[model samples]
Target chain A: MINIGVDLGGTTIKMALINEEGKMIDKWVIATNTIDNGKHIASEISKSILKKIRQFGLETSSVHGVGVGAPGFINLDTGFIYQAVNIGWKDYPFKAELEQLLGLPVIVDNDANMAALGEMWLGAGQGTRNLICVTLGTGVGAGIICDGKILHGVSGMAGEIGHITVIPRDGAACNCGKTGCLETVSSATGIRRMALDALDYIDSESILRTMFETKGDITAEDVFDCAERQDPLSSTVTEKAAYYLGYALGALAVTVNPEKIVIGGGVSHAGDALVKPLKKYFRHFSLPKIADSCSIDLAKLGNDAGVFGAAWLCMQK
Target chain B: MINIGVDLGGTTIKMALINEEGKMIDKWVIATNTIDNGKHIASEISKSILKKIRQFGLETSSVHGVGVGAPGFINLDTGFIYQAVNIGWKDYPFKAELEQLLGLPVIVDNDANMAALGEMWLGAGQGTRNLICVTLGTGVGAGIICDGKILHGVSGMAGEIGHITVIPRDGAACNCGKTGCLETVSSATGIRRMALDALDYIDSESILRTMFETKGDITAEDVFDCAERQDPLSSTVTEKAAYYLGYALGALAVTVNPEKIVIGGGVSHAGDALVKPLKKYFRHFSLPKIADSCSIDLAKLGNDAGVFGAAWLCMQK
Candidate 1:
């Protein structure tokens, strides 16, 4: 039997038909309709699923269940979304409504968690039962997999590693109303912020200064490009970002002691430029035993990680 | 059936006869014979177990197996001691040797892991499946229990929270060859060190100065006593120690998101004097949601936690 996986986001809704072995048989994406506070989302998802079933000439019985990776604090057992700031969802009975509309069992979890599960199942963390998957995008996010299971704490907020206070004093303010969070120094936005902050003190000969003068704003990509060329200012910014990220990972290494740490998201695309420095900081911050045991690697599945992980949720049940 | 639990430590060996319900039916202690490089330790343990069985008029067949909580990096599946620094054990076949000597199945794990398991089974973390148990004795040690199982990272070193870099720069040196670790500030030795350091900058009128002048050396207990009396120097020292500890715990709360944090060890005896200030620092450091969900409580089992946790290991198989 096959399973349906849904990667639900504020901008788009991506869906996939997955086989028992986690292979995606077919997939499609639809622009999200957030009209009327997303009241029609469940119906739209059901309609899409039915259209796909009819188009492929497959019976409903062929689909085992539907698993969704949603952006919010989800009640895994109840399928309730306590809050989703971007989607404007609050106390939404997501699972019950989706199950009713699709006439199939539905499972839902945090999107980052799904991405981690996806990596564990078919990406960088394959064959490792315990691991941590971190996404360094606009904000730093993480998902913890312990003994082949997602660790959902009492409130399904177990892997909020981004909010960890990396700089205890005089740190930048965070969106979460806190200061010195890992996200402040490690995320794509954070890297860009660091680059911008450095422009004032940077040497006039620096390429990053030239880029900032020409572009009005330097992105994390711009910072990486300049660093790759050995620009002192850009290299300093990247080094600091990598240090905070690696230090946070080191703290996690000693706490959960996962077999592997899978780094994902846009920032991780820097490849060796990011991981080489991260591994060094990780070793410096962790105990020798922990530093020697856990392997750090980049995520392989990218965006599809959510859908694959959603399908994994269906397979689990 | 009954299970035998051995809490092997540097100074003494504690043994317990436990029932299926996790209750300790009988218990005793013997001074650890670490002479001759600890070679005779296993045979001594077996002899003690045999003596207890005879004294209680119990049959050998009535005991299911033996569970040993040893101080070191233990290979849980193989019952091997990778390295126990205090006992001078290296690559010792702990389980096989003990099983052969006692004529029963044997299970082994790190002492801290056992203490955590013990607390989860019958102490402060009794009803919680996910929790972190920290011991703040001579050094800081931790045990992580996720979903009712001990989190033994790759090579069984998952819960080494002591070595997490709390002070990123200009922090004190730790025996682990790291700077600014939580143990360097929060452990018993760390607390005493802080107290001694405070003597230089402290006011001459402070009571701690008097105590130091009278005794020539102040213990961690002396610092706590002086703090209890609101002595300025001792209070400042305890506050700094508590802040570092709380900061480390806040990092763990965001990373692991355990339902509770059970603080064990000698320092925890300070009770509300320690917890009240620690809670304030934890709240200041963590995301509000995390600070609200994960509780910080004292460990209820104390030294007996190791023995109970060891018995829990035997019960698993």
Candidate 2:
């Protein structure tokens, strides 16, 4: 039987028809109509699902169920969206509404959790049951898989690794109103901020300074490019970011002790330059037992991880 | 049917006959007798089990199995003692030996993990399926319970929260060869060290200073006593230790996000003097979503947690 997967994001809603083997049969994306306080989102998703079924000439009996990975604190038991700041959804009965509209079983969870599950099922963590999947984009987000299940804490706030107090004191302020979170040091935005901060002290020979002078703003990719070329200022910034990222992973290693830690998102594309130094700091911080056993690898599926994970959720049910 | 629960420690072995409901029917303690390369330890435990069975006039079929909570790293799947430093067991086939002696099933796990299970089964964590049980004795050890199961990582070393590097830079050296580990700041030894360090700058009129001046070496209990009376130096030391502990818990709250954090061991006996400050600092460090749901409380079962947890292990089998 085929499963329908919905990856609900702030900008777009990506849907896919996934087979039992976790391969996508067909996929489509629609603009996230967040207007009207997201009132039409459930109906819009339902219409898209119906159209996809009709277009594929598939019977409802062939479809297993619908699984959604939404952005926010999700109540797995009720499929209620407690809060999705960007989508303006609060205490919305998303799962029940969509189930009623489509007359099918619906499973919903946090988007990052879906990505983690997706990676675990079909990507870097293929054989691992215990894993941690971290996404480093605008902010750092993580989904913890312990013994092959998502660790949704008491309030569905488990895996808030981004907000763990990394700096301990006098660090960058986070959107969460916390200081010195891992997100403030390890994300793409954090890397650029670090590069911008270094510009004031960097010498004229630094490529990072030249990029900032010419473009007015340096991207995280530019910083990685400069570091790859052995630019001193950029190397320093990348090392610092990698250090914090690795340090946070080390902390997680001792806490959850996952078999594998999968790193994903835009910043992870820096590849070896990012992972090499991160491993160095990880070894320095983790206990010997954990350091020796847990392997860190890049997420292989990229953006498709969410839909794949969403489909996996349906399969689990 | 009854289960035999063994709480193995460096100094003594506490054995109990626990019923299906987890109540201790009969209990006894014996010297650990770790001499002669620890070869006789298992035999002694086997002898005690047989004697208990005969004395109670119980048939072998009436006993479920044996469960042991041993110190140091354990290979849960194989029941191999990787290394119990004090017990002098390294890569020993502990479960096979015990099972052969008693002709019954045997299960073994880390002492801390067992305590966590015990607490969840019948103590402070009785109602919570997801919990973190932290023991703050000479060292800080934690057992992470997720969905009613102990989170044994790839190497069965998942709950080593003690070794999580809390002090990023130059902190106290830990026995694990790490600097600034949570154990260095949150454990009983750490609390005493913090109190001793405070002696250098503590005012002459402070009761902690007077205690230190008279006693030469103050105990953790003495520090707590002084703090209870509002002694400045003791209060400062407790607050510092509590801050580090709460900070570490805050990190755990986001990572594991257990339903409840049950604090046990020697230092936790300080009661409100410890938990109140810890909760305050935890709030300061955790995201409001996590801080609001996770409750930190003292462990209820105390020393009995290990035996109870061991019995619970047998019940699982």
Candidate 3:
């Protein structure tokens, strides 16, 4: 059977046509314009997905189901994206609209959750019944899978680990209008901000400053590169970010106690440069038993995780 | 059919014979001594349970299974209590020992988780599939239930909400060797500490001072009583404690997204004194959609929640 998986992001709509074994036969990426109406966007997604399926020489009737992964609060049972800040969506029935447009059943879920599901089926988390995936990029995203099932909480927001309060009283300003949220201290943005803060505290000439001076923006990636070269400032900033991130994961381990944690996204590309330090600090903070049960690894699927996870979802039923 | 449910605590072991519909047919409590060997204690429990069954005119063979709710890190699948701080237990297989003594199938789980499970099945959280039960006594205990099943993470250490870090960095000393845990700021002990802090910061002729001066120890109950009588110091302390507790719950809500949070134990007896203020602050700190999906209420089963939840566990498969 062929399943169509769509990953809807703020900037692009990526779709894949996959076989029963989760092998993507064909895929396409289209630039998404957020200014379009919800129905129009849904129609566009349908067209792109159909085009991809035809390009792959797959019959429409052969398609079992279509799954879409969105970046926000999505009610998995209801197939509604309650809210997606990046896309200006609020309680939009993307699944129903897309089903109408394509004349096929559609399943919708939070993108981060789908990514974790993808990893569980075909990436770093394969063969594990319990795992958590953390995506460290422009923003922090997390997905928790337990007992071979993705846990969709009462509001389908069971895996919002980024907002878990790591900083109790005060630390940094989070976009959620709260001070010292975990995202504020441990996300890619947080890591870059840490470098800027360290620059203010200590005068240092390094690769990060060069990037900021030239590109007008410094990312967590530039800091990782600098840290790899043994730059003290970048290393200190990245270490601090990893420390808090690990602490948050450690505390979360006490709460959720997953067997493995798969770290993904742009920042996770730094690999052990970030993970080794994170593992050290996570053990330092969590209870011995909980810390011992959890192991961290980088996500193996890269960009294909969305397609893999969304396909994995349809395959579950 | 009858099912024996036991709640094992430091000072006492409470047992009940629950009918299929969850009615308590017979109940008893016995003193539990830490000095007693685990095997002997298991024998005693089995004997007492048998005595109760005979007295209630129920045949021993009619009893389907035995369920035990214990404190500390437990292996639910293995029925082993790895650690119970209050009971001084370590790697004790109470289930296997008791099964040998009574010749009946036995199941064991974390006491707090069982309490939350009990509430989910028959108490305040009845009819709700996704619920979080928080027991706010000397320490904070939490049980997270999703999709009608207790989320017993990979290591059976899931739902240890008390140990989740609430403070951004570091604040007070916690029993878990970590500073600024949620229990440190939200439990009964936390309220007492906050009350003391308020007394030092605010200058006033307060009932709390008189009560504390007259009584050697200041209690959360005393502070609540003082606040009821319009003591400024007590109110400030309650507000401060409520604010942080609500903030932590709000952050937790974003991640867990439970449909309802059932609060129990000693401090929860304050009812609206805690819930009202907590709701106010939860709204201030929670992600908008998460806050909307969750409702905070008092747990109904009280001390019996453990046994009931354990009994419910028996009926599961």
Candidate 4:
């Protein structure tokens, strides 16, 4: 069956037409108009989807349904968004509005959950019933899948991996109002912060200093690039981030016993630079048996995971 | 239908005839024959079950199946005990042996997992689909129930909460050959060790000093008893254990977002003394939304959770 997957983000809405085998039939992106608390989001998305359908000469009858992943606390059954601060939505009947406009069944879940399903369905964790996808973006997020489905806890607050305290003592403050969360150490932003903090080290030599002096600031990519070039200060920063990320992943592995952990988000582009030390520290912190059985890998699907996951959600219904 | 539930332990084997509604029809106990690597256990268990059947004048047809809760690394599907050191079993075909002798279908799972299912079925976590049961006995063990089924992970290693590190620095070692594990602080033995170590505190006014001077050693119960009588040192020890437990549970809440967290085993007997401090710390560490949604309570079935869980397992099939 053909289905439409919508990935609603703050900057853009990614919509994809996916077929029965999960291949993308076509894909489109539309600006997320945030004016007036996103009142026009449903109409915009519906129009875009219909436009794509007509262009492909596909009848509305050929479309099975739509699945949308939004950044919010959502009601899994009714697809209601309790709140998505970035999108300026609260108590929005997301599914009903879209269904009314499109005249089809729709399924909704949190964006992180959708990405995890996408990874499990056809990416790094492909064919694995039990998996965890950790996204190291500007901030950290995780999606836990067990028994071939997402784990949404009582309040859809499960997979808040970034908020878990790795430094249970005095650590850097996080935007979430907590101190020393995993997000404060391992996210792309966290790596950049750590790199900037290391600039005053007593005896350190690094290319990052020159990069910072020239560019005004260094990114997480600069740290990985410097580390690969044998830059001591940047290597130290990467090692510390890897240590915490591995430790948290180790804790999660035993908590849910996932078969594979797929690292995604923009920061995962560091690839082996992140996965190598990550595997080392994850094994160091995990139970010996679990550390042996669970595989940690990099995500392959990149930005398309959400759309794939959204489509997969519609197929489930 | 009537079925038999078995709780296998190092000291004895507890076998109970449980009805379809989970009521215990009759119970029997037999010494665990750990002689020669538990070679006689299967035959002994079958003989005892047959004797109980004759006592009730029940035919073989009346019993539908048998479910056993064993302590060890188990293959849930095959019911193979990889190794249960205390019971001296290794690579044992538990299901086949029991089914061959009793002429009935049999299922087996780790004891902790069974206790969790039992709690979900008839104890504190009754009817809750997403639940976590943390058992604080001689060691810490956990059972994770999500989506109304036990999460076995990929290798039956899920729910090893005890092994999760709480103290990331120099701390006490655990039986699992790890340091700073939650098991080193939250288990019954851990509490006893903490109380003993606290006795050397200068200017301490705890009655625990007198108890240890007279009795030579103190149990965790003595620590709680002393605290109830307003002993400062003992109270401090209990508080510390409660803090670590609460912190770990809070992290776990956001990981899987269970509807309830059931604290069981010997340490849980401290009741409100443990739950109160635990709740405070749990809320302190957990996301406000998750803390508000999930409930932390004591286990109701005590030791009987194993047998009830075993029977519940049989009913599921």
lDDT by residue (A208-314, candidate 2, tens digit) is 78888798889999999999999988899999999999888898899888889999999999888899999999989999878888899999999999999999999
Per-residue alpha-carbon lDDT of model 1 for B150-201, expressed as tens digits? 8787678877888889998998999999999999999989999988888976
Worst lDDT window (10 residues) for model 4 chain B?
B197-206
iRMSD (1 decimal) for each model:
1.2, 1.0, 1.7, 1.0
Worst 10 residues of 2 chain A by lDDT: A200-209
RMSD values, in order shown: 1.5, 1.5, 2.9, 1.5
Question: Could you tell which candidate, 1 or 4, scores higher by lDDT?
Answer: 4
- Model 2 segments more than 4 A misplaced: A201-205, B201-205
Ranking, lDDT, top scorer first: 2, 4, 1, 3
Local distance difference test scores for all models = 0.89, 0.91, 0.84, 0.90
Native-to-model Cα distance after best TM-score fit, residue B235 in candidate 2, in Å: 1.7
Q: Single out the weakest 10-residue window by summed lDDT for candidate 1 chain B.
A: B196-205
The clash number for model 3 is: 4
Fnat of each prediction, in sequence: 0.77, 0.81, 0.70, 0.75
lDDT tens per residue, model 3, B203-230: 7889999888888679999888888888
Runs with alpha carbons beyond 4 Å of true place in candidate 1: none
Q: At residue A211, what lDDT does model 2 achieve?
A: 82
- Candidate 3 local Cα displacement, residue A74, angstroms: 2.6
Number of the top DockQ candidate: 2
- The candidates' DockQ values read 0.75, 0.81, 0.59, 0.78
